[model samples]
Target: MSKIEEVKAKVEIGKTKLVPALVQEALDEGSTPAMILQAMVDSMGVVGDKFSKGEIFVPEMLIAAKAMAKGVDVLRPLLAGDSETSLGTCIIGTVAGDLHDIGKNLVAMMIESAGFTMVDLGVDVPAEKFVEAIKENERVTLVACSGLLTTTMPALKEAVQTIKAAYPDQKVIVGGAPVTPEYAAEIGADGFAPDAGSAAVKAKEIISV
Candidate 1:
């Protein structure tokens, strides 16, 4: 098979150690840096879909993301001049009264892979902090809020509402264990994703519109 396809396959299986070398090999074989990068990104998209479908769990998904990260590291130098996927800065954080981070971290990585510059606010983030991040960051095209609990769901709503109150047109996407599309709509979020994989897709969709 071609080096680019090999890179994609290795990344999907989470071959963290092998993906870098394969990416380099693909570069050696005359594959353009952009094409190789897209291969890895597409691999993550496949991995994400599997995660959303329950075919794989967190460890598997994280492994694939790490593999893609390794490949990206190999291509980062060559890609310095290629600003094609820059969707602008995205602010992400878990809502207040909740400390869960695995989901948020996963979403952050996937969203970054999809080309947005991520500013992660980490866990237990208060509502105003989301707005504060938007105000502080440049070209903030999207804000992503995560909540992993039923109780902290209100914090998610509060966070989205606060950001909307401050910046009515700010695009917000919400997700986590307890978040639903209906709830996201009620909370004034621009979008809702069911899992980390779809979060990247949702982030891109929110930014594009």
Candidate 2:
């Protein structure tokens, strides 16, 4: 098989140790960094789908994400764009009372790869922390909130409302398992995405407006 396909397969199976070397080999074999990165991203999508289908559990999903992350580290410099023309800083975090970070970390990685500098607030973040991060950081054009549990969905709303109220023009994107496009609209979020790849797309789209 081709090096790129090998990279994808290793990532899909959560071969954290081998993915980095395979990603490097893909690059050496004339595969563009973006192509290799997309391969890994696609692998993550398959892992997510498997989870959704109950074919794999959280441990498998998490391992796959870790493998993808390792592969990304190998490609980061090549994948990154010129910082002088960056979209802007993006502050991301899991909403208060939620401890899940697999989704949030993936979104942050994707958004950063999309050319936005990211300031991650980590998990269980309070609403005020989102505001503070915006205030403290320069040119924070987007705030992406993630919540993995239905119970923490309210915190997502509160975070959006709090950020919007404080900075009326701030662009915010919300996501996680329990969040929907309709709910994002109702909660005053500027955008919503179901996964990391689309989160990057939506983040770019909203910030350009």
Candidate 3:
């Protein structure tokens, strides 16, 4: 099989140590950086699908993401770094009073695998911090607000409202256990995702429009 296909296969199987070398080999074999990166990205889509379908779990998904990340490192220099070919920059965080990060971290990885440059602001992030991060970052195309607890749903709404007020045209996506499509729309979010895999798909869909 071709080196690019091998890279894809290894990445899908969560072969973290082998993917980097295979990616480098693919490059040496005349495969373009975009070709190799796209191969890895496609593999990530497969992994995400499995997770969404319950065929795999979080540990497996994390391992695959880590493997793809290793492969990405090999291509970064040739690709002009991670975000050069990305859909755009995505600023993500868990809204204020919410210290939960497992869900937020998963969504961040899934979105990054989908080719958006991720700027993770971490947990317990204030509503104002989301706006501040947008102002502080470059090429900010999307903002993601996450809230795991029902109590923090208000903080999630505030985050969306704060961002929309700052940049009316900016795309913002909200998600987590307590966030619903109705709530997402009610708060003026451009999109809503129910889980990490779907979050990546919705992120790409919203950002494209």
Candidate 4:
């Protein structure tokens, strides 16, 4: 198999060392950093597909994301500075009343690995804060919300409504343990993801549209 394919498979299997090793090998072989970065992104793309299909769980996805991140660090200087290469920008946070952030953090990292610039707002973020962040980062095309509890899920709706009221063209995406596409649609969110890997895919799709 090709080196890129090797990286993808290692990410799929959650091999922590394989990612950095593959990245180093690619660099030593005279591969451009952009090529390595693309391979890393494509690796997560496959991981995202598996996640959406329920072929993998959160723990596995998180590990794969971690591995991908290690590889990205090696390519950042070479690729991140290339404005022409990035897909878009994203603003992500766990909605107000939700202190749990492992899931949200993973999604944020996954989105970053997908070649999007990410501004992570951390946990327990209010709707107004999201609005303020969006106002400041005009390039942010996607607003990703995470709420692991049923009670906190309402904050996702509030954020979506608040953003839509101010910026009618903004897109809001929701995710977390308790969030579903049905609930997301009910709350007027633009999209929904069940896991971090899928969240990356969702961000890519939403931003491109």
Q: Tell me the tens digit of each residue's lDDT in model 2 across 1-209.
A: 99999999988899999999999999999998878877876687677667656788767766777887788788878867644536789999999999999899878866765657789999999999999999999999999999999999899999999999999999999999999999999999999998776677788789873
Candidate 3 segments whose C-alpha is farther than 4 A from its true place:
81-84
Residue-by-residue lDDT tens digits, candidate 3, 1-209: 99999999999989999999999999999999999988988899899889988999999999999999999998888888545578888999999999999999999999999888899999999988999999998899999999999999999999999889989999999999998899999999999998888888888889773
Candidate 1 lDDT score relative to the true structure: 0.90
Clashes of each: 0, 0, 0, 0
Model 2 off-target regions past 4 Å?
79-90, 97-118, 135-142, 146-155, 167-169, 175-183, 191-209
* CA displacement after TM-score superposition, residue 75 of candidate 1 (Å): 1.2
**Candidates in order: C-alpha RMSD to true structure:** 1.7, 4.3, 1.3, 2.2
Candidate 1 differs from the real structure by a C-alpha RMSD in angstroms, to one decimal, of 1.7
lDDT of 1 by residue, 73-143 (tens): 99989888666746789999999999999889999988887778899999999999999999998889999
Best by TM-score: 3
Q: What is the C-alpha lDDT of each candidate?
A: 0.90, 0.86, 0.92, 0.83
Give a tens-digit lDDT track for model 4, residues 1-209. Answer: 77766776787677887788887777887788888778778878888778778988778777887888787777777775687667767899989998998988888878887888889999999999999999888577888888998888778889888988988888889988888789999988999988777788888888773
Q: Spell out the clash pairs found in candidate 2.
A: none
Higher-lDDT candidate of 2 and 4: 2
